[model samples]
Target chain A: MGTKAFWLATTAAVLIVFAASRLVTNDYVFFAGYVVLQYVVLATAWNILGGYAGYINFGTSGFVGIGAYSTVVLHKLVGPPIPVLILVGGIVSGAIGLGMGYLTLRLRGVYFGIATLAMAIVVQTLVTNWDFVGGSRGVYIIRPAHVPFIGGYIQYLFLVMLVLAAVAVAAARTIERSVFGFGLAAIRDDEQAAEVSGVPTLRLKLIAISVSCGLMGMAGAPLPYYVTYLDPASAFNLGYTANTIAMPLIGGTASWVGPVIGAIGLATIQQVSTVTISSALNLLIVGVLLLICVVVAPNGIVGLVRGKRRRAGRGG
Target chain B: MADDLLSVDKLGKRFGGFVALDGIDLTVRAGERLGLIGPNGSGKSTLVNCLSGTLRNDSGTVRFDGNLLNGLAAHRRTRLGLARSFQLPKPFRSLTVVENLRVPLYYSVNARPGAPHLAEAAVGERCRELLRLVGLEAKADRQPQDLTQIEMRKLELARALAAEPKLLIADEAMAGLSNSEVDNILALLMRLGDRGIAVILIEHIMRAVISFSQRLVVLVAGRKIADGDPHAVVRDPEVVRAYLGE
Candidate 1:
């Protein structure tokens, strides 16, 4: 789609979602919708570094957990507004991401991935020991009955997540179209070749990681308010890491639309299956779907569709 | 000496006590076509790597356009008008043929100082022109995987050319091509040289090297055995003994 049409379609989609949320009286839909939107943000964020640059970052939970804990600390210390807390969370995660990139981005392939995984463990340990943000025991967050402008607290949280998701998708789309995107694609194809082609690979990778981690943190900042509780275990949940990585991989890792499609599809399936079968089966479902996608459609749904169209064009 | 586009002095590299390039000195004047011929494991690739900043020398200086390039990274060197085509074609597999050229043009050429900023249309136009120069204009939209052996080599050269480099080191660019393909690549290298870009053609194909090179340098056992006119260098006793032992 053209840039103007894309924005028009996105704005219309956001409005439709907002209007639809107003018509529904049940709080369950908003709560479920919040989870899906949050995944959209996480998946898109991860795709920036992982999909575009071909740097597998296994530390989604670390950045998200940092954002969640940032919100908790801020809420306890000064009780800033949620938006302010989100911004603080993003800055904190972005800084950490930048530091991590500087230190570990020199390692390529699996070693770099292993470093990110280690980062998650280290963050989890630190959060576990810290008593201010509720240590291992966790802390309860008292929520007001309603937010001022938005009637219900859940509705307000859902709206925030929806906006964040839209912004992440838009940003990813912009990066995919820019010179920066081409550079990232070159890095993904071959880093040595990209460097020889005069691409500043290190700078681009740092930018990608910073943006990606910042978005993840932003998505996590409001989680304390959504869940009405926070702890190291829930905040640094492996589910966040698994789902964020799996969504983009299963949806398609190449484009902005891939993560969105993957997140919505996978999140809906998980939500439905959690209710129908058992909550324990959620991770199982994700694992199975990931495997199936890797084997059957390695390029994800978008790639599959494109491949079909190309084949049909040739045949005709 | 100051007019030399690339001057390497006392360049040395070692891999865990095994000397790869030892105390090598070389120079190429602006727009010169210098062929570098060496036996397998004779450190030709290593020398190219050092000159292109892909590998760092243990000692010595690589002065490119009179600037010291010892610690500079490969991409930095590329931005400063130095480029190389890999021995194996490393085209961006996901991008189309034209898009492959766009990477270097967008990054290297556009990044050059005092160069006019290229618009999207101008960039596209340059990409087509590069494809035509390499005789791959008809396959502009094709992927690298779809390219034939010669076409892949052409794309490799085209990618290096996109940098608008003052110096290009082509590492075995015509390795597996047929006779006509070898001549085709030699002609392309000559065309590039005519445009005032110094070229270091590292090849084992003596016929192509002899026909293309204005000067030839021979490396054997990580040491320069001969450096002079192509015919004189080939006829050197040391060069012949290194190649075909009597």
Candidate 2:
């Protein structure tokens, strides 16, 4: 599909989903749905760098922390609208992403992953020490009871996250088809070969990281309002990093749809299990599913499906 | 020297105590088919690496098409029209054979100064043309793993050519191929050279090298020992000794 049509379709689909979601009278549904939608954004964001560029970034929480903290800082200072907060959050985290890539892209392989993990730790430590945005003590956000059109603040956050998810998916799909995306894919395959083939590997990597982190930050921007209690521990949670990485791997990293599918499927399962089976089983569930994906379908669900289709075609 | 397409003066590279390339001097004319032959650990690959900006040379200058490529990145050098195929085929394993060629076309060729932005159709056309040139049109959609060794070599060459390079350094492109496949790659290289693209074919296969190169430069122990007519370079005593271990 053309880029324009794809975006239009995506926007339409998101509106439909949002409109349908509003019909549910239960506020808890919005609360759970918001988390699932947030993953859709985070996983898609992570895939841009990790899956597409083959640079595993263990700094999802770091970027998210930056975004959430940016909102908190802005909320304390100017008290900007949530949209402005999201934009500012994206910019701050994207710049950090670019800076991180500059410092560590040369490391290659697991070293780059280590550098990102270290960056997350560093960011978390900074957040913990900074008292302005509530350091180790944590801070409370008093969100307005109801938004004008959305009725409830949680519903507004849900609507914002849904839109962000669509945007993230659309952006991913656009990059996947562009020349820039092709260059990124080349770097993922073979860095030296990509370089000699005229791919600006370092530059592409920086752009990938920046975009990935920017979107991640956008996902995190709403968290301060969602939880109403923001702390370094929760904002910089390792759970965000793990889920961001796992979603793409479980769904398939080769295409943009993989992360969306992985995020929706995995997040929904986690959400459902957290309610039905105890919240303690969340990590255990993620672990067992990830293990299954790694063993039974190393390439993830998309790869597994593709393999089956190929085999069936051959057989027929 | 100014008229030469590529000129290297006193290029040196040392990996700690071991000297990989020591003050190597070489020049190639535009569209020149220059075969670079060297024994194992003789620094032919090292020289290629320096020229292509894969590794930084510790000393000396490399002037390619009037630009002094001292600290330029590999992609920058490629954008300046220098390209190379890997000794082992490094086709983007995830990409199909044709898509592998698209990478260079997108980044290198289209990125050139004053180059028109190629339409999507044009890019696809260019990829197909390259596939046809390398005789991989039949396997354009096939993954790199599915290709035979020779097909992989062809894909590698096609990928390099997609950059529309002024100079293509083919590093052992014909290695491990059958004799007919060697000739096949040799013919392909010769065809590229005829299209006004200078080629530096680094190969262990003497027959293919001799038949393909108008000039042969031999490297022994990180130094040039013989450089001149292909036949004479093969017969050079030092080159013979370097190969046969006299």
Instruction: List clashing residue pairs in candidate 1.
Output: none
Residue A245 deviation, candidate 1, in Å?
Answer: 1.1
Q: Residue A257's C-alpha lDDT in candidate 1?
A: 91
lDDT per residue for candidate 2 within B86-149, as digits (tens), equals: 9988989999888998898889888999989888899999998988888988998888999988
Residue A220 lDDT in model 2? Answer: 92
- Per-model TM-score, in order, reads 0.99, 0.97
Off by over 4 Å in 1: none
TM-score of chain B of each: 0.98, 0.97
Query: Could you give the fnat of all candidates in order?
Result: 0.76, 0.98
Candidate 2 CAPRI classification by DockQ: high
Worst 10 residues of 2 chain B by lDDT: B237-246
Label model 1 with its docking quality class: high
lDDT of 2 by residue, A1-316 (tens): 7777887889789889888987889999999999999999999999998888999999999999999999999999998889999999999999999999999999888999999999999999998999998899999999899999679998889899888898899899989988889989999999989999998898999999999999999999989999999989999999999998999999999998899999999999999989898998977878899999999999989999998998898896
